[model samples]
Target: MKKVFQLILIIFSILNSAQQSEIFKLKNYRISVLNDSIQETSGLNFFSEKLYTFNDSGNPAELYEIDKKTGKILKILKVKAENKDWEALTNDGENFYIGDFGNNAGIRQDLKIFKIPFKNNQLQNDSLKIISFYYPEQQDFTPKNISTDFDLESMIYLNGKLHIFTKEWASKSTTHYTLDPDNFEKQAAQKIETFKTGFMISDAYYFEKKLFVVGYTKKTEVFLMIFNESNSGIFFKNNPWKLYLGSALSIGQIEGIAVDETGIYISGEKFYSPIGNTKPYFYFIPKEKLKF
Candidate 1:
């Protein structure tokens, strides 16, 4: 009986090591400190060869274009809409969409996304569209700060629709939902798929038929997940290859991800916890390094 127990313990240790080995460290990463104006930067998007980012709640309704190399604010565009918890940014080649649905507590009913048109690399303040939506599954209007699954922070514009991924703190899983971009009516988002991520999904990026999600666990462990797209605008149906990139202590509460032909870019806001404080920083991972 003692020999059998010893053998089982050895097998368990090996399996645990194998799982830990799958987690790659972000050793070859660059950290660029953002300007003080964008200390609470929440979203990132690459449009027309420019990198765009914005602050979350309590900040101005504006967009900032930062120098990717130095993290310096190059220009600021004053948005005509309110910035009530703008958490995600994405573009459909012509217009930019800003997600104002930063529901940390599942009590907000005014979840909205601002659609702004741009011409000559400048925002046309005359034409602004507001897209309001709600989840039909959520019935409770009570506020539960960190115990609700209705909070959202990730979104993408795909196939003429806005795809939203919920930041479910209750189940640690993300639900995929789609909303009409053109319709101004208060539409109910159609839940398409749900994946057990085991971590909150803060932001999402779709590139080369692959979907990449960036998030962190409560323990401050940051992770990146890559899923292969099986069909047009459908990636949750496939299993994702999850990799523990690093810790939020070093990565600073990652909230945004944007990919281009060069590589992947991530941004983190200033994070404070009982453990310590992480400064607001932007990190770049080259395409070659992610080949592993």
Candidate 2:
């Protein structure tokens, strides 16, 4: 019996090591309703101190810009076709890249991200770039059965490359992968690392040497994982993912996160169906308040 107990303890230790994540708590900020009509928001981004989001409720996905710290909608931009299925959003310091690749069932044969260039809030023609790619290892569109497996929900740009993180709803764990920007082919991403998040990872952002990933469980929450590395780059592998904040029980779905030298920003997507529509949210945690 003693030998058996020791073996079980060893096994549990190894499993725990593989599943550890950040130590900080997640915090969610509330939003005031701007419109009861703009519903089922799917994608979001931060540009020029403003929050930009898109909806996938019906034909012609619409774009809305709002104040960075307030949920107030400032402007509603042009629409771009129907069923774009906007999933994730990122920027390259100059233009915004909107990813329309939401393969929840894994059956999608074609996936793409649109790069829309913006100058002083005005759209530019022929400046639109679409990036297309797919998963190399996946042969079928079956839901993942494992704890740490999930589909794509969010991503960010690090060192000129697009790093995508998956949100495995069934497993509550997150996986990390990277896409090369210079490689126009937009090949299947290479696996970088995995954080046994133990929570749904909705979006990620890299700022001031720290990485912030947000999601929730019993309630809407955010996980702030900080990376400590040398100038060589790959050294980030050694950084520990710790819990950042735990917000109010009322905080809804946190779908997007973006960071700058000033502070960190997050956006909440409205839940649809019988419950009706909830207002979109733009909340921020200052740079000084974010613990490294």
lDDT of each: 0.86, 0.60
For model 2, residues 91-192, the per-residue Cα lDDT tens digits are 776767676766666566666666667888865536666667776766766654333243676777668878787777666766677776655565786776
Q: Model 1 misses residue 7 by how many Å? A: 32
Query: Where does candidate 1 clash, by residue pair?
Result: none
Question: Looking at candidate 1, what is the lDDT of residue 169?
Answer: 90
lDDT of 1 by residue, 15-45 (tens): 4533753676663585687789999989899
On TM-score, the leading prediction is 1
TM-score per model over all chains: 0.91, 0.74
